[model samples]
Target chain A: MKLTINRNYLNDAIQQVSKAVSSRPAMPILGGIKIDVTHQVIVLTASDTDISIQSFIPIEQDQMIVATIHEPGNIILPAKVFVEMIKKLPADQVSIEVEDHFRTTIRSGSTEIQMVGFDPEEFPLLPAIDQNEIIQIPGDLLKTMIRQTIFSASTSEQTPVLTGVLWNLKDNVLKFVSTDRHRLASRTAAITAPDQYQFNHIVIAAKTLSELSRLIPDQNTMIDIVVAENQVLFKVDNILFYTRILDGTYPDTSKIIPQTYETEMVIDTKSLLEAIDRAYLMSREEKTNIVRFMTIDEHTVEISSSSTELGKVTEQQKVQSYKGEPLKIAFNSKYMIDVLKVVDSEQIFIGFSGTMRPIIIKPLDHDYNTYIILPYRTVN
Target chain B: MKLTINRNYLNDAIQQVSKAVSSRPAMPILGGIKIDVTHQVIVLTASDTDISIQSFIPIEQDQMIVATIHEPGNIILPAKVFVEMIKKLPADQVSIEVEDHFRTTIRSGSTEIQMVGFDPEEFPLLPAIDQNEIIQIPGDLLKTMIRQTIFSASTSEQTPVLTGVLWNLKDNVLKFVSTDRHRLASRTAAITAPDQYQFNHIVIAAKTLSELSRLIPDQNTMIDIVVAENQVLFKVDNILFYTRILDGTYPDTSKIIPQTYETEMVIDTKSLLEAIDRAYLMSREEKTNIVRFMTIDEHTVEISSSSTELGKVTEQQKVQSYKGEPLKIAFNSKYMIDVLKVVDSEQIFIGFSGTMRPIIIKPLDHDYNTYIILPYRTVN
Candidate 1:
């Protein structure tokens, strides 16, 4: 393989695929990034069995030549070294050539580096997915959905399926839900896809979704998602991200969401978050992270936490509106802080069934996002 | 103690003393910050046996009231919790009051925190330093000198004195030197002090100097340093920093620096640094960080590194001036990078006696700083 490419363009493409490079590869070849040079484009691929990422650089972009291909061939280079070297190359343009026996020479400005490359044939191939049924969603919307729900997914491998976010599609409306049996987050969005196409019980690992989120451009572009029997492919711009579908059935979480509340209140999101944050400093030292919330009056609420060794922290803030009986409840301040951070509304609506039941939190202006937290039982 | 102090001023004072708080305190009380509130100022102190720091917040500074003291007393609060809480307090002025039984209440805006405090008498007191003789130096100059030489200090405890930087005062000139056997860095500067106050063999731990560096103000101000029998006291503005001197004799490193050179070259500091940084990516993977430098003709030099598992990297750059015989030498790229990072010169002069002798690096424009690196004997 022989080609000259813009250093910045090559570096950007390498960074995109580097997320899939495993730190501890199951096979030595899995630690390599496969480089393929064709007549029209150069493709970089990295995979770790569970997740695979491929990025392409075309010969020309925006009337500027990004890469010049002298010959078409393929070689695999160690990802860890290649990524760092490309980033610090001393010139705007770099030339790479694969000589006999897979010895590759990379030259830029007055610097030249020779790297030993492995035969590309030894690298694992990406699973091919049938794209007959493609679901298209806005990149920013999908990124938001992932950010809002992915954090609630369980990180432990004991229940492998809970480590992924469940995706359900019905009537062109896609919904995402994730829970660790302690707290749950769900987001719903409308997507453009074939009316006849629908998927259920499809779960993608939180780790995979996070990588996809980073690859998604900030601009409002369309992303095509294709799901195979056991694989999912996300076509984002010139990048293709593929991941294996998590096996096992995800537990039904629909029944756990509270439908009604005995006590409801509207509070400023930032104010409540700040109050809980101060209380968290004390609770965190105790390792329980339990912060108590009590309604002081129709328009005021108090947040407090205490450590047996480090005294207590109490703060009161005014609520926007309250329309129920006064109540007291305690919860893990860390979880509440997480939910509040992602809430994009100025005011949030909080509903409580009782002290022991699950508490529901939602943006006052929107019904698409819902977060439920189980309150801690405290003997007061 | 009862006082209302500006949150920012209190926060800045706390941050200065927080550096001395040990993560793993030998005694439980050592993890607390002693707070002494007097009529004129509020003193915050933290000590961990080896080092102690005290910062004072006066009642008024720069025509602005920093603190209003209603009652004078003393108390000690947990450093970890108090530092974090003070940083995020919700008001500009926070009121702190000791109620009874060492229960302290800190009130800011609508938030109130009660913290359990330890007896101030139990906290370790700072060592007294004699001030009959004092050395005064510009804060910025001291900061720069520490930055240039501190990186060469040995971190291993086997030779405790090597972990400290040697300070020699003679004829109103103060010199700092540090070495870890393979590499040495020294910087010299003139200070205002009594001619009769010359002192030698005074070594301060690199760790303590690093913390002192952070507390130094960026503005040029005279800092008074008093050397005690085993403790050194630095009065930096309103902050007092005390550090224990490392025991043991420091080895003489003066002979290792080349007095004469067989080959001398002047090159742009930034250009050479960039080339070696790229080579580091390759050498670092081998864990040896070996990079070779050879004079090419009279005006050009080549920098390269090779690994048995990986291939080689070669780069050549032009030198401003070259004199004496041509030579080739190999050294650790990581150490060279550290020396180059602190060089505040556009061009650097490199002197090499031979392939095996130690190489000397200095700013081409000044004689205040010097760095010596031992070359590696490679089989090639």
Candidate 2:
């Protein structure tokens, strides 16, 4: 294949696909990115066993020339070294040519590299999926939903399905849920899709979903998502991300969420996050990174943590309001801090049923973001 | 000890001394910083078995009141935790009170921390040294000299003295030398010291010397260096750093640096460094990360590296002149890049004795910077 392309566009496409290229691949060919130069477009593909990414650069983008194929062919080059060489090449545009014998020549300015390329036939074929059962959603909204709940997914591989995030769709609202048995994070977003398009439940590996979010740049446009029996594909801009769906069904986490609360308090999000961060650092040398919050009066709240071996830290954050009986509870500072960072509200309302109950934290004025954390028992 | 100290000043002092606090300290008390509060100054001291740092924050610094002591006493607080807490304190001035029994209470604004403090008498004291044999040099020049030669020091502790940089002073010239057997780097600087401050040779651990350089702020002031029989002390500004000097005679590296060359070429320092850096990234996957350079013509040079498994890269750099006979040699790209980064001159001249001998690199102007790299044999 022979083609000339803009350095920036080619770099972006290569970077997006390179994320899926593992350092040590089960199949040696998986470490290389397959480059196909067609008459119309140049497609770049990279995959490990878990996920595969393919990005296409069309011939025309915003009136600028994307690529011109002098000869149509294909070649597979080492992803890492090739990308690094191209990035450091001292030229505005790069020309890539593949000989009939599979020798690839990359030239930019006076710098030229001749590398023995692998036959495209050796590269794995793209997974075939019917797009009939597809739904369209705003890229930004999908990215946000993934960020808000993906962190709660279990990283352990014993229950493979738990390592994935569950996506449930009804009407026009999309809910994302993730749980690691100890804690749960759920977020929902309003998406525009056809009335006929519906999905009961789909589980995609949390890592793959997070990688897909990074692939989608900040664009307000909508991307099409298609789910085949055991595969899910997200067509984000010029990139297509495909991941194999988990086989087992996800556990039901609805009952674990609290339905009511005995006490609720509204506190500034930034203040509480900072206090939790400080307490987290203080607990590193202790058995448990524990931080406790106590409501003394109507407007006074005290956050304190202590380690017999590493001393104690007490931080106070003022809250706007607190109701019901005064309560004191201790929980992992890291968990509460991670959830607080994703909540999109200036003030957060924290609910407490009792000292040992799993506390629920949600936005004071919104219902889209919800996080629950199990509290640690304080030894008196 | 009872005192109220400025938070920023306390943070800076804690940060400077915290480097000496090792996570796996040899002794329990060695992990803490001894805080001695006198009527005039608050001295913070932290020490490991190898190096010790003591910084004094006086009652007043540059017209700004730093610390006010109500009761003069001493206590050793955990360096790591204490530093973190001081950085996060909320108030401008923090009140630190030590009870008669030695419990330390640190309060800033509404935040308070009660940490277990050890008796100051248990802290290890730095060895006392007479100031009769002292050498004064520009702080900035000393920092530059350390950066230029420390990289060539042997990192492996098999030969303990090789891990240190040899400091030899005679007359008004101070020389710094470090060698890892394969390559050697030596630099010299001119300074004025007392007639009695004549030193033949002293070796300080490169790691300790580098850390001491960081303590010297950006200033053109003079720094007093006192070399004891088994310790070296650097007194700069209000900070005093004492490190145990390495015993045993340093290997002679002066003979390894050749006096003449077969081929000499002058090239732009930035261009040469960038080309070497990019070439290094490509060759790093191989065994020695070797990059070869050959003078094609009087004004042109070619740099190339090829890995049998990975691809090859060739870059051309324009040089001002190529003296002596045309030559080609290969050396470790990483070492060349590291040495090139320290060159302050715009144009650097490289002198080669032969293809097998070590290649010497110095500024075109020959103003005190020199780097020698041993060549690796190329397999046919």
Predictions' DockQ, in order: 0.81, 0.59
Query: Residue by residue across B168-260, what tens digits does model 1's lDDT show?
Result: 999999999999999999999999998677999999999889999999999997899999899999999999999998899999887787678
lDDT of 2 by residue, B221-293 (tens): 7899988888888898878899998987897776787788999988999888878777776788686889988
* Superposition error at B325 for model 1 (Å): 2.7
All models: lDDT? Answer: 0.93, 0.85
True contacts recovered per prediction: 0.91, 0.65
Worst-scoring 10-residue span by lDDT in model 2 chain A: A192-201
DockQ of 1: 0.81
Query: Which candidate leads the pack in DockQ?
Result: 1
Query: What clash pairs does model 2 have?
Result: none
Ten-residue segment with the worst summed lDDT in candidate 2 chain B? B192-201
- Deviation of model 1 at A265, angstroms: 1.1
* CA deviation > 4 Å runs, candidate 1: none
Question: Model 1 Cα displacement at B216 (Å)?
Answer: 1.6
For every candidate in turn, the CA RMSD to the true structure comes to: 1.5, 2.2
